[model samples]
Every structure is written in C-alpha cells, then in structure tokens.
Target chain A: MSDFLMFSLVPMTVAIVICMSCALLGNFLVLRRQSLIGDAISHVALPGIVASFLLTGTLASSAMMLGAGVSALFTVAMIELIRRLGRVENSAAMGVVFTSLFALGVLMLEWNEVGTVHLDVEHALYGNLESLIWFEGTSLAALVDPRALSDLPPQLARVAWMGALVVAFVVAFRRSLVLASFDADFAASVGARPTLVGLLLVVMVAVAAIAAFEAVGAIIVIAMFICPAAAARLMTDRLASQVALSQLIAVASAVLGYVLAGYGPGWMGLGVSLSAAGMIATLSGGFLLLACLFGPHRHRREALST
Target chain B: MEAWWRALIFDAGYNTSLVTLGAMLLGGGAGMIGSFVLLRKRSLVSDAISHATLPGLALAFILMALVFGDGRWMPGLLVGAGLSAAVGLWAVQAISHRTRLGEDAAIGAVLSTFFGLGVVLLTVIQSMAVSGQAGLTGYLVGSTAGMLAAEAQLIALCSLLLAAGIFVMRRDFLMVCFDPVFASTNGVRVQRVDMLLMLLLLAVVVIGLRITGLILIVALTIIPPVTGRFWTDRPLRVVALAALLGALAGYLGVTLSSVREGLPTGPLVVLACFVLFLVSFLLSPRRGILATLMAHQRFKRRVHLRQGLLAMARDEAIFDDLTMRVLRRQGFIRRDGVATPSGWAAARDAEHEERLWALYRQYYPEESAQLDHRGLLPIERVLSPDTIMVLENRLMMGRGAHP
Candidate 1:
C-alpha cells in the first residue's frame, strides 16, 4: 500500500502543481485578452523540446525547459512579425506560425531518428505521466532524508520551482499586471511600462508552460491554462479571487481526474486505465462547462475585475 | 534525391500521383474558402470548429461500429464531423454573446475544451474492441500514403463544387465581407451569405481532414489567403492566387513526403505553405517587407536631402559635393554647383514657405498644423486672401514678428 501511495503521490502532486501554476498565470492571460497565447506557446514548444533533445542528446529537464523557453519566445516573435509584415490578423498569424513550427518539429524528430524507446512522438504528444515515480517512502521523514529526496521524480522539483517562481512574480507584480491588463495606456501614463509588464507576463507564462510540458503533454497544459482560469473567471469578479479560485479548481480537477483515470474504468467494468492527462483535461473542461451553465454570478462586472 | 525527383514528376507510382492530386484539390478548395474566413476574421472560429470535429468523428465511428458493425464509411464520419463542428461554432458564438469574456477567450476556451473532449474520446476508442479502428487514428496527423483513390475522387468532386459555388456568389461574399451593414441595407441577406460561406468552409475542412488532419488543417485555410494578401487587394484575385499557392504547396509537400520514407505529410504541407508565405512576405511587390523598407529608406533620404536644400535656401549652410551631385542628377541643381533658374525659384519658394510655417507655428501653436513637405503650399493657396490677411494681422499682433 505504501508502494502504491508512493507511486501515485509524485504524479498527483506534479499534476496539481502544474495545473495550479498554469491557472494562476492563465487568469492574467484571460483578463488581458491574450488567453490563446498560452495555447500557441504550448504548441510551439514541441519544436523546442525536439530541438533541445537533438542538440543536447539528453532529456535533461533544464535543457528541455531552456529549449522550450527559446522556442516559445521565438513563436511569439514570429507571430508578431507575421502580423506586421504580412498584414494578417493576429489569430491567423498565430495559426500559421505555430502549426508550421510544430510541423517542423515533427519532421526533425523523424529525420533525426529521435523516436527511441524512451522518447518518441507519442511520448511527446501524449506524455508518459504514469512513469513519474519516486522511490522515497510515503512519509515526511523520508521526504526530508537526502537519499529519499534524491530518488524523487525530477519533474516534481521542476514543477515546485516553477510554482514558486510564478507565485513570486504574481505577488511582486500584481498591481502593474492588473493595470496593464485593464488599460495599458493608462498604465503607461502612471509611469508603469505596460509593455515591460506584458512581456514579463508572457515570459513567465512560457516558463510555466515549458516546465509542465514533460509531465502533462502540450495539449493538457493548454487545457490547464484556459479551462480552469476561464471557469474561475465565470465564478468570481475580482482578479485576486479569480487567481486563487482558479488554483483551487485546478487542484480539485487534478485530484478528481487522477482518481477517475486510475479507478473509474474498473467501476464501469471496462477494466482499462485511461490516459491520466486526458482525464484531467476532460475534467477541467467539465468545470468550465459547469461554470458556463450554472455559476451563480450572472451580473456582468467591469472587464478588468477579472 | 533521385527518388524525390521521380516523385515530384509523378514517376513514383500511380498511388503517389493520386494522393498528390487529392492533396492539391483539397488545398485549392481550402485556400479559396479560407480567404473569406480570413477576411471575415473568423479564422479562430474555424479553429474551434475543426477541433470540435474530432470528438464528433470519434463518436460517429463508435456509433456506427456499435449499430452497423461497420464504422469505416467515410461519408458518415464526415457528416458527424460537420455536425460537431457546427456545434462548436455555435458554442463559440454563444459564449462570446452570453458572457463577459471576449471572443479570443471564448475561442481559446472552446478550442481547448473541445480538443480535450476529443482526446478523451480517442482514448476510449483506442481501449475499445473494434475493427477498422486503425484508420481513425490517421485523422489526427493524417497519412497521405494511406489515401485511397476513392477518397481522392471525393476530394476532387468537392473541389469542383467549391469552385462553382464560389464563382456563383463571389460578389455577395465580397459585399458582406467588406461591409455587412451596407450589404444588409442593400437587401443582400448577409446572414444567409455567411451561412453559405460557413457551409463551404465546413466542406473544405471535411475534405481536408483526410489530407492534413484536424489539428493542422486550419493552416491550409489561413496561410494561403494571408500569403495572397501580400500580392494584391482584389478579392477575386486574392482568392485565385491563394488557390494557386495552396495547390503548389500541397503538390510540393506531398512530393517531398513521398520521397522520404518517414516524413509526415500534413505538417510538411503546412511548412511548404509557410515557405511560400515567407517568400511572399520578403519579396512581393506591393506589401512585401523588402518593398516597404525600401520605400521607407527612400523617404528618409529624400527628407535628408530636402533638409539640406532648405538650410542652403536660408543661407545657413552649403551643400557638400555629394549632395550637389545628387541634386544635379535629380535636376534640382546645376553643373557649376550653383542654383539653376528652377533651383533658384525653388530655393526662394522654400525660404518663403519656411517663414510662413514659422509664422503659423509661433502665432497659432494652439491649433496644431502639419506642413506638407511634398508641395509648396503658400498660405494663399491653402487659405483665402481675406483669411490670410486676418491671420497675418493676428500673427503680427501675437508674435511681434514679420513674415
């Protein structure tokens, strides 16, 4: 039983951490009218992940995160450039840039024969969250022990690091971020460089996305960024509460999704465990639907309040 | 390389030729329909709709498998996809209308949520015991190598209908896209036209699913029209050019993928479109980046040269030899480094213009006025003689300066 608890503990914690951090940043994105940027960055991260693996020939988390960060920034830059030079709408620009980059990533993966047993297109697309195991005993003492600590899943540590970084960024820059989102020109008039704040926000979101890519897959990360945050937006009328509520929703969905993925099929007599990431995405999407349909708050609040 | 060359020339095999032709047909249709979608700024809606089709496709397959013991019928699956896409489109509209969220958020929410549902359905299908389920997976990334001649025929037929439909209502599509309110005032039934366009877009997406897959199929519609916009502004020409570019990209991508054993066709096709877009972005005559930059540089240089001439006119500076040469070459100066008759007239005119601007700036600073650098607009030309007299009187009173 302890072994079972140990096996599921790391994946569950990582899932919750990934969801919570993404949901927190996602509220800002939804408020700023840039929610889709998270989806674009996650899609573009595929190329970054593949390029990192190719260049370093290792799946080291740092290399992957760095590569994904570069790729996400490049994607953002390319989208802006396309919108300017091509005179295309921003959405079309995003569609063109990320799809082509994703395509390029796939081609590179095939050409380099990077589809080894450990890393392949399927793993990149769907992820292998099941293998996020820790050899530590299921106890607080074991967690503190250096040997047991060393045996922990590396993805959990990365998630924790990103979670802390995201939290610090939000706490320090909340006022400026809110000002920028509400009215950038007004923010500028008040001696706040809205452009810098906006850039920092995107960079932070990209960082969180790159960190979560290995554990939850790109698709689920997109879900975490949009669904819970959107649902939270429906539930509340304040930015701080939206952020906190989104994190709560994300944690609940993670817990529910993990349990359902593990045991729901047995209850249905299907005797097959489904993909945990997909289950989490579905559950978060369900939260969004419920919020859309039945959230008690119906009065439209001021736009920036979210 | 030789194999690639052979494939490019249709010497690979009959199957290769058929698949390439099918891809081209699908690309042409998607490109044409995508022009309207891009112009209408509904590209994101199309994205949500396409993603929504995945779950519908899976549901269709599941239902057909359980009911008829055969789920591989292409038409039934497409009908399912179309229905689901319509639902997704309706959801996007409803969300933006019913909630405080903007359209972008609605698009993002619907896109991710529907795609998430599709993923769940996909896993469910994979776990089920069913035959003919293998081909369903190809709808995710698309496999051009697995395309059949029958499917190619369907794509060709759809392309024919798409071309004809676009030809019939090109004017209505144009009017509604540019000015829906004006079109409505003219009794053009804008909503019906939008519905027709939506139907056509759905058809293109359905055909494209077999060629490019769900995730990247929106690219076929978006990239071509955007690329075409670089070349022209005429609606029909843009649509025609987009169709041509789309076909070219489709042909080349399939040729390359056929030559390489492991290359995925859908993304390769998108990459090909992107390369074309990149070329057009850099080199197209009208809206290309290079042309815009050149025009900007030319304007800057002209401004610099004009500033030099203006200073010389005021007797505050003299031209360098290089400046004189350039001015002489452009017939703005003479060979002896002195002003010609026209140049002298221009110099006096420039000096007079400067005084007038200075008078206006000093006296009427409250009313921001812009100077027209291209033309020597004397105050008399822009204002009536009586108004100029009044302005001169006011200026003399206000500034204690003479013009």
Candidate 2:
C-alpha cells in the first residue's frame, strides 16, 4: 500500500501542481480571445522536440524548452502573417497556421529516423512520469551519502522550477496582461505596447506548454489549459476570482482523477490513466453546465424567461 | 513521379473510388451552402457541431455492440452524429443567450466540452473491445481507404437532392441573405428560411465528416467560400465559384494524397483551397490588391491632367506655350498645350463649354471680364461676339444649375 502511494499517489501530487499552473495561465489566455492558442502551440511543439533531439543528441529539458519556444512563437507569427498579408479572418488564419504546422511536424517526425527522437516525441505526447523520476546529480549523490540532505527527483525539481517561474511571471506582470487582454486599444492609448504584452503572454504559454508536455501529451494539454479557465469563467465575473477559481478547480480535478484512476483499477482490473488532463476538461465542462443551469447571471434568467 | 501519378488516378479500389466521389459531391454541395454561411458569419458553426457529435458516435457504437451486434452500425453512427449535432447547435444558442460570455466564447465552450465528453466516452468504449465495433475508431481520424459503395451512393444522392433544393430556392435564399427583414415584410417566412439553412448546414457537416474527420471538417465548409469571395462580388457567381473550387480541391487533394504515402487528404484539400485564395488575391480584377493599386494610380493621373488643362485655360498669355508643354509631357496635349488646329478648334469649342464655364465660375466667378482681358477667352469670343451669345446658348442647354 505504501509502495502504491509512493509510486502512484505521489506522482499525482506532482500532476496537481502542474495542473494548477496550467489553469492559472490559461485563465488570461481564454479571456484574451485566444482560448485555442494552447492547442495550437502544443501541436506545433512536436517538430521543435524532433529538431532539438537532432541538434543535441539528447532529450534534455533545456533543448526541448528552446525548441518549443521557437515553434510556439512561429505559430503566433504565422497567424499574424496570414491575417496581415492574406486578409484572412482571425479564425481562418488560426486554422491555417496550426494545421499547417501540425502537418509539418508529423512529416518531420516521420522523416527523422532516430529511435531516441521517436521516444522523445512519444514523451512529448503522453508524458513518462516513471522515467521522469530518475535523474543523475545531487539527488543521486544524496542517496549515496547518508549525511547529505535528501533531494527530490530531478523530474519533480524541474516541475517545481517551471511552476515557480509561471507563478512569478503571472504575479509580476498581472496588471499589464490584464490591461492588454481586456482592452488592447485602451492599453495602447495609455502608452502600453500591446504587442510586447502579447508576445510575453505567448512566451508564458510556450513555457507552460514545455513544462506540461512531459506529464500530459499534446492532445490532452489543451484540455488542461482551456478547461479550468472556461469552467472558472462560468462561475465568476471578476478576472482575479476567475484565475483563482480556475487554479482551484484544476488542482482538485487532478487529485480526484489521479485517485480514481489509481484506486478504481485495483478494485476492478480496469487500468486507466484517469487521464488527469481529460478529467480536468470533463469537470470544467460539468461546471460550466452547472453554471448555465443554476448561476445567478442575468443572461440565464433572460433566456429562461424567454 | 509520372508512374505514381498514373497509379493514383487509374487505380480502381472500390473504397478509393467511392470515398472520392462521395466526398466530392457531398463536400461540394456543402461548400455551396457554406457560401451563405460565410456571408452570415456563422462559418464556424460546422466546427462546433462536428466536435459535439463525438460522444454520440461512441455511445451508439457501444449500444450497437451490446444490444444488437455490430455488423450494421452505419445507421447508428449517422443517427448519433445527427442528433448530437442538432443538440449541440441548440446548446450553443442556449449558452450564447443565457450568458454574457459572447458568441465565440459560447462556441468554444460547447465545442471543447462536448468533445471532452466524447473523449471520455471513447476511452470507456475502447477499454471494452467488442468485435465489429473495432472499426469505429477509424472514423475519428478518417480512413477513406475503407468506404463502401452503398455509403458513396447515399452521400451522392443526398448531396444531389440537396443541391437541387438549393437551386429551386435560390431566389428565396437571396432575399433572405440580402435582407431578411424585407423578406419577412414581403411574406417570405424568415423563420422557415433560417431553419432550412441550418438544417442544410447540419447535413453538410455530417456528410463531410466521413472524408475530413470531425476535427477538420469546418475547413471544407469555410475555405471554399472564403476563396470564392476574392473572385466575385455577385452572390450567384460567388456560390458557383465556391462550389467549383471545392470540387476541384477535393479531387486534387485525394489524387495527391494517393501519390504521396501518408498525407491526410482532408488537410491537403484545404491547402489546395488556400492556393486558390492566394492566386485570386494576387490576380482577381476588381478586388485584388494589385488591380486596386493600378486603378488608383490611373485615377490620380487623370485628376492631375484635368487640373493642368484647367490651369492653362485660365491664363491666355501662357496658354499656347503651356498647352504645348503640357501636351508634350502628357502626350495628349501636343507640345503646344493647344489642341493643334485641333487644339485651336478644341479651344474654340471650349469657349462655350458649360463645364469650362462652371470651372471658370468656381475659380473666378466675378472675373469674366478679367478672363477676357487676360486672353483666356477663345479668339472666337473676340472675332465673333456671337460666341458670348453661344455661351448663353450653352448655359440654357445646361438647364439645371447647382441651385
């Protein structure tokens, strides 16, 4: 039982931390009218992972980080380019860029013959927590030397670093992000560079994407990124409260999903990932439905009265 | 390359032939309807409906396997997709009306949530691997390599009938799109027209799903119309052009994918539509960027030449020399800014011209004598005082002045 807790439940604790970070960042993204930007960025990150492996001969976190950032930035640039040059609408531009990038990524993956690259791609999709728990460094040294202070596994350490960075960036630039998100024209009139703020937000998305790619695959990351914020939006009018509630929902869903998947299979030989990401999305949808049915919002009353 | 192309085009696999024709006919009809959808700004509705139907598909598959066996599942899947899409549309409208979240947000919410539910349901279904139900998984990603002839015929017949319906109702559709309020005022039954359009949109989405898959079917319904926009401003022309482009893209997309080992034909077709868009953006006569720029330049030149001619007429001392110089430079004026003898005759004719008089009045209304003193009046004015009589003749002919 302790072994199960250590291996399964403990890893889920890490998932909860990651989901909270995703939710916090996602709230601002959804409010900014770029809800699916996360989905686009995650899919576009595939080629970046492949490229990084080709360059470094290792699936190092730093290399993947740099690659994912470039790909995400490229996706944004392509969307802007399509809009400006082709005169296509925003949704159309989004569809064109992301689908093209995803197709290109698939082509690249197929062309690249490296076995390790394929593994990295798989990890980028489904995440490999079992492998993530092993790292070679101070933690390994501490394990050998009893007198030394114990250290967390390298994967946990990496996740903590990512989570902390996301928290710090959000806190530091919350006001600017909010200004640009709500009324970009007003922000620009008031001397803020909405473009720079937008770039900063994209960068935040890229960073969060890379961090979560190892835990949840690309397909599910969208759920983690958009679901919590969408759910929170149904519950609150205030941006701050929405962000807070989103994080809470995300963390709670992650924990519940992990526990359910972990325990349910034992009772009935039905092993499922509980897909922490999928659960968060499902729960967020449920929350939105609940709000639609029972919330005190005036629109609901008007719709019902009609 | 040549051999591969031949193989792709000539290969007679039952599924390949059926899927291609089915997708083309259905996708084309959808593209035609989608033209109106794009105009109405509801182009993304297809995407919402497609995603919302996933759970229904999964549930239907599960029920088929458990209750009646799975050899016959197409009906179940179609019913599932149809029901879900309808419900999804209603849900979208409900969310938009019942929340301050806005239309796009409501759409995003409905699409993702329903899709997530579908995924959960799919996961459950996949865990219990009942035979014959296994093939349903291919629908998610789409595999045109396995389409049956009956399915193809169904798609073609439905699409053809629908296309005919659209043709019959073209006038009503035009009135509905251009001015629904006016249509209603004229007893057009706007609500029925709207319902018909929505039902058509839903049918197109379901039919297109077999080829494009649920995730990307919106491209078929949207890209062709958008590409059509660049080529024509007339509604009929736009719809025709869009349908043709949609069919062309579908054909090329399938053929190309067959040549290339693993390219997804749906996205490839979308790429082809975008290519059409690019070509039209660069070369379309009226709306293309290059054409507009050229037209603007020509207009500016015309304005400049007219201004120079008016200036020469106002100054008789420089009139001959200026006319020569302006004509030499403009190629229409001759080195003598004069109309030649043609220049002299043109100047004489200009003396009684009402437009010239108007220009004169606009610039020097109280200086008619000054103009004569300055030699701006044609020699005919001095040689034949009848010219002033002719100017009065011209003024009377002008009849209605800017009172």
Using TM-score as the measure, the top candidate is 1
**What is the TM-score of chain A, computed separately for every candidate?**
0.93, 0.84
TM-score of each: 0.89, 0.75
Docking class of 2: incorrect
Chain B alone vs. reference chain B, TM-score for every model: 0.82, 0.74
Candidate 2, residues A1-306, lDDT tens digits: the string is 434434654366567777887778888877786766776787678777777767787878789778877888888897786576557677766655665555445445534555344453334544554333322223334445545323344556667778899899889887778898989999899877787888888888888877777666564466667667766777777888888888887777777665654465556767654444445456666666776776554253344554
Q: Per-residue lDDT for A1-306 in model 1, tens only?
A: 666658788899899999999989888898888888998898878899889998998988789888999999999998988888767798889988988888888778877888773665556666667788776767767767899888888888888999999999998998898999989999999978899999999899899888888887877788888888888888887777888889989999889988898788889998777778878887988888788888755336555754
DockQ, all candidates in order: 0.63, 0.23
Most accurate candidate by DockQ: 1
Interface RMSD of candidate 1, in Å, is 1.8
Worst 10 residues of 1 chain B by lDDT: B368-377
Chain B TM-score in candidate 2, rounded to 2 decimals?
Answer: 0.74
lDDT of 1 at B287: 85
Tens digit per residue, CA lDDT, model 1, B1-403: 9988998888988888888887887788788888888899887677777788887898999899889887878888888888888888777877777877778878877777777677677778778788888788667766776667777677677777776787687788889999999999999999899989888887788777877778788889989989998899898899889889999999998889887776778888989999999999999989899998998877766665566568668666454655665567667666776667777676676666566666666666654255454433445776567756765676566666533
